[model samples]
Target: MNAVTRIGQVGEKAVFRRHHRKPDGRSLFLYGFAKPDGVSLPEGNDPVAKGGELRWHPFRREWNVYAAHRQNRTFKPSSAEDPLAPSKPGGAVTEIPFETFEVAVFGNKFTSLHPEAPDPPEIPGVSSQPAVGACEVVVYTPEQTGSLYTVGQERRRLLLSAWNDRYEALFQQGCAFVMPFESRGEEVGVTLHHPHGQIYGFGEVPQVQRQMASAFDDGFSLERLLPQWSEYSVDEAGGVSAFCPPFARFPFEVWLTPRRRVPGPWDFSEEESDGFAHLLGEVTRRYDRFFGRDTAYMLTLHAAPKGCEQTFHFTAQFYPILRAPGRVKFLASVEQGTGVFTVDVMPEEAARTLRAQ
Candidate 1:
C-alpha cells in the first residue's frame, strides 16, 4: 500500500510526496512537482539486512562503525541493473516502485546504521555499543544519468526542500547530527553512477562537528573570515556566498554559506533557501565548466548539533579532488597519518580560474 500527499509548496512550485514500504520493510519516499500516480506495490519479500555496531576509537576519541555487511552492497552495476532506477511497471523491482519521479529518497539497503540495531557484543578492552542511527539515499533524478547540476533549477529547489524535510524529520527521530552529503564521481569512491546523495543521522556529534562547536565558542567568526578571503569570493546571490577559504585544504575547495548563519537548512527563510539552491547549482556548474568535465568532489553540509544551534554556523564545503584537469590529488601519508593536508593550488589562483568560468 502507498499514499501520496501534497506537502505544501517550495517557492511557486507545488511539492507532493508519497511514502512506501518495500517488500523487505525498508522505507521509500517519492517527491515531485505533481502528485505521483499509477504506483504499483510489488508483492513478495526479501531478507532484511542487519545493522552494524559502533566501537570506540580510544586515541581519536571518536566512534567507528563496523559494518561487515556493507562489503556485499551493490557496486557499479551496469545501467540495466542500476538499483537506484525507478522500478518498471512489470519489469524488475528496484528501490522505487513508480516508473518516474522528480526525486526519490529511501532507506539504504546496505546502511551502516539502523534504528533497530542490536547491542554490540562484548570485546575485551574495547568499548562498543549499538550503531543506533540512520542512513538514506537521496536520488536526484529518475533518469540515472547527468549530474546534480544538470537537474535544472526547479528540480534543485525540490531537492533542497526534500533535504530540509529529511533534516527536520531525522532530528525529531533522535539524530544528534544530520548530514546531507554527496560523493560525486569515481575518484571519490562513489559506487553508484546515479545522480544522488546520502544523508547520515549520527547518534552522536562526530569529531569535526565537536571541534567546530568549540571553535565557534572561542569566537571564531565566519563574518570576519569572509572579509579576509574577499578576494577569493566566487559568487554571491540571494543571501548565499560561495568562496575559497585562504586556508583551503584542497585545490579548488569552495565553501557556501548564508550571510547570516541559521543552525541548518530547516532554519532557512524562503529567500535564503531559494538563494542556497541557486548558488549550489552555480558552484557545481563552475566546477564542471572549469575542469571541462564532470569534476569529482566531496560536497558536505555542516550544521549545528541538535541542541547547539546558536553556537554553530551552517556551511557547505566542496572539496574537489582534482588539482588539475585529468589529474587527481591523492591523500598521501602526511595527510592521513598526521591530518595535515598539503594543497597544491593557492586559493587566490583557484578562485580566479573559477571566476573566469
Candidate 2:
C-alpha cells in the first residue's frame, strides 16, 4: 500500500516527506522536510563536518556530546522571521522555501550529534566518538503559534506516520536508537515558540534507554504489567492503551503502549497507528482542560535499540510540568542531585483530575 504522500528534496541534505490521513471522513495534509542550514555556521562549529566531539564520562560510564557550537543556535525570533515557517511570498527565506505546507521536517541548525563526522581524538582514560548522529526538526503546522494538542485528529495521525517514516529511514542509516520528542513552553526552555518537535537519531544507545533494555534483558515483561499497572487508563483502542503509570515522576505524566508487543514505531500495525494517534490527541486535550490553559510539557518516545526489538517494548511518555494554571513544577536540588523525583500530586489524583477534565 502507498503510505507516503509526497517525497522530494528541499535544501541541501534536506528531504521533504508528506502524508495524508482521512479521519472523520475528511482528508488532512501533513508534510515533513529535512535539511541542514545555518545562518551562523561560522568557521569552527559545523558539527556535521568538524569539531563535533563526544567524550566518555568515566564515573557515569556514559557518552556526553561536547558541541559547544549549539550555544549559538537561533533563539526567540519575531513572528515575521519565524525560521520554522514556510517561506512566504516576497519574504525573507526561512528553513522551508515552500510557501504553504501542512507540516515540515528538516535538519536542526543546532544539534548535539552529527550524521557524519570523524572520530574524536581519543584520550588515555576517556573514550570518545565523532558525535555522529542525526537531529531533524518536525513542524506540526504552518501557524506561528498553537499547541500540538489543538491540532486536528487528521494532522496528528499524519504526524505519527511521519515519525514512523523518520524512524525507519534513520535506522537504515545505522542509527542505533531514535527518539522523537517535543519540548513545549518557555519553562521547558523552548527558544522558538513554533509548534514543532524533534527526532534525534543516536549512533549509540542513550543511558536511560540502556537501563530499559537491561530491564527487558532481566526478564521484566512490560506486557504483563500493561493490564494492571496503570493508575489511570486514559484511552484503550485498537489494542493500544494510554495511561498514567503509578510510579510516575511527573505529576501529570502519561504513557502510551500497545497491547501487543512491538519493537518500534515501524512495527506498528495500521490499526494501532490510528488508535495511537487518537489517544495522543485525546490525552493532550485532557491536559489542556486540566490546566484551564496551555500546558508546558515534554513528550518523548522510548523505543528498543535497532537490533533489540523483541525484548524491549516501545512506549511514549508525556510530562506536563504545570502544577496549576500559572504555577510550574521546577526540578529542585533533590531531583538534580540525587536523581530522585518528588512529586507533589499522586498519580492517582492526577489521573482523577485528567478524567474529570
Candidate 3:
C-alpha cells in the first residue's frame, strides 16, 4: 500500500494542494498549479480573447473544442527557463515552487477547457456549448529532460499510482471521460520540450471512445480480439498484455490491456499495477531503441466512461509516428478527410520488428 500526504497549496486556487505519495517506499509529489509566488503567470494569447467553446460538426456528428488561446503556449524554451522544472531557492521561479520534488501534477496554464467557461453565442443550425472541463499537466520528474521510459522502476510505479488517484479524483470533479495522453517530439506537434504528459477531463465522451464502447456493446471481447489479432505476445506479464492490433493506424502502434476485465487504471490491484508499469516502461524503451533515436510518438490511456466500467476493458495505446529512421509518417488526405487511416506497414510486420528489437 502507498501513503499520500497533502503538502501545501499554490496560486489563487488555494484548494489545489501539493500531494506527496510513497510508492515502493520512495517519495513522490503531485502539485495542482505552476508559476511561483510573486511572479505573474503568463497570460494566454487569443487575439479574440475567446475562451474554449464546443461546436458540433454536422458531418462528423461530434463536438470539437475551439481553444484559440493555446497559440501563445510556451514553445521550446532553453533548459534554464524550462517551466516544468522545480523552482530553485534564489533562481527564477518556474512552475513548481519547491527546490526539488518527484512527480508533479498541475492545471495546464493554456487550457483547452475551463471550469467557468462563458456561454457561446447561438448560431443557426450549430449546436454550441461551453468547453467546461479540466486539463492537467503531469510532470514525470523534477529533472528537465528524459523520456518516461528512462524514469526508472520506482518512479514509473509512482506515476501509475498517481494516475489511479487522478482518475478517481477527476471523475468526482464531474468529468464524463478522463483521458491521459502524451505527445512527444515536434513531429507530434509537442510545443513543450519538457518530458510531461497531459490529462484532460472531458465533460462529454469523445467520438472515437464512444465508437470503441459501442464495439463492446456489439459483443466484442478481449478473448475474441486476442485470437484474431495478437501481434506481440510478450505482454502477458502480471495478467496485463500488450499487442499490436490488426487495425493500427500508425506504423508501430501497440495496445496494452489487462488479461482480465478491468475498468481503468484505478481498478488495478497491487501486482497488476507493478505489471502494467513494467509493460508500459518496456514498450517505451523498445520504442526509443527501435529507431536508434527518440521516436516521436503519442500515448493514450483509453478507459470506459464512468458508468460503463464492467462492459469495457481499459486499454493504453501507443502510436509512434516514425515509420523509418529519420522519416516521419504524415497523415494527409485520406486520414484527415475521411477519418479512415491508411497505414503503409502491416501490423504483423510492425509487431515483428518491435519483437526482434
lDDT of each: 0.87, 0.75, 0.75
Tell me the lDDT of model 1 at 62. Answer: 92
Tens digits of per-residue lDDT for model 3, 1-357:
223344322122222234432221212235333322222222223232324999999999999999888888888888888888877666665766566566778667678886666798899999999998878788988877788778876667767766766788889988999998899989889877888998898888999888888888788898556755655453556778878887788888888888777878778776777778888888888888888888789999999887888688889999999888778898899789987888888888888888877
lDDT of 3 at 310: 68
Candidate 1, residue 72: lDDT: 87
Best prediction by TM-score: 1
Where does candidate 1 have its weakest 10-residue lDDT segment? 37-46
Give RMSD to native, each candidate. Answer: 1.4, 7.7, 7.0
Q: Write the per-residue lDDT of candidate 2 for residues 1-357, one digit (tens) a residue.
A: 114434433222233454322222211223544322212111112223233688988877788888877778888999888987767667865765556666766666666777665676768877888888888788888888877667876667667767877888789989999999999888899999989999999998989999999899888876898778656777687789988888899988988889878887667887887778888778888888878877889999998987788799989999999876778999999899888999988888887788777
Error of 3 at 230 (Å): 4.6
Off by over 4 Å in 3: 1-51, 227-234
In candidate 1, stretches whose alpha carbon ends up further than 4 angstroms from where it belongs are 41-44
Which pairs of residues clash in candidate 2, taking residues 3 or more apart in a chain or in different chains? Answer: 14-34, 14-35, 31-103, 32-105, 33-105, 34-106, 35-107, 114-133
Q: Between prediction 1 and prediction 3, which has the larger lDDT?
A: 1
The local distance difference test score of model 3 is 0.75
Total clashing residue pairs per candidate?
A: 0, 8, 0
